[model samples]
Target: MTTTFYEEIGGSDTIRTIVDRFYEGVATDELLRPRDPEEDLGPAADRFALFLIQYWGGPTTYSDNRGHPRLRMRHAPFAVTPAAKERWLVHFRAGLDAADLTPEQDAQFWDYVTHAAQFMVNSLE
Candidate 1:
């Protein structure tokens, strides 16, 4: 059987660690914290963990629960400015670093997030 990027990177546990660490950063971020209206970040973290897991090729549970990701559309409610994107990447970089994947795996994962962050920018401000 062919292994997936999810499996290659150590599956759900790694993804959860990455998401948890990312949220740890987000919890204290002024800009990012305002973006999440919820006082408790757990649900948001859970959603993100599921999304990353599915996107990286694990179970389809994210879609199963949330339907199509419609990423840009879903993110439309937020300003998503370039600065916000940069800040988002900074926290995400911490998450990636915590995962400690192989260099190639790290590069691949980073490449996707960099582009995704840029794509998420909905405002020039």
Candidate 2:
């Protein structure tokens, strides 16, 4: 009866903390704040938390609820310019700091965020 690294890091609790912190920045960031300033990020937050936990080898809550992430289609409405990309990364990096996860975990987490943000960039204008 031992917890995996996913559970060792506190599973959903840790994921919630990370998502909340990231969204807090997104809510106020100059580059990313305009589109969804007051939008309900609650659902989005839950989705991300579950997805991360599952990806880390925890439960499959994300897939249970949302099939596949299909992140690009989800973010297609927004104009993810370079500034917005930077802002998203800034908030995500801050969340990693707040989580205070191990260096390995931090690097892995940031890798996903970095690639995800890059993929979300739909325009060069």
* TM-score per candidate, chains pooled: 0.98, 0.83
- Write model 1 residue lDDT over 2-84, tens digit each, in one string: 99999999999999989999999999999889999999999999999999999999999999999999999999999999999
Lowest-sum lDDT 10-residue window in model 2: 29-38
lDDT of each: 0.95, 0.81
lDDT of 2 by residue, 1-125 (tens): 97776787778778888889998887777777777744787876777788888887799888888898787887888888887898889998888888958888788778878998888998886
User: How good is model 2 by TM-score?
Assistant: 0.83
Off by over 4 Å in 1: none
lDDT value, residue 68 of candidate 1: 93
User: Each model's number of backbone clashes?
Assistant: 0, 0
Tell me how far the alpha carbon of residue 120 in candidate 1 is from the true structure, in angstroms, after superposition: 0.5
For candidate 1, the TM-score is 0.98
Which candidate number has the best lDDT? Answer: 1
- Residue clash pairs of candidate 2: none
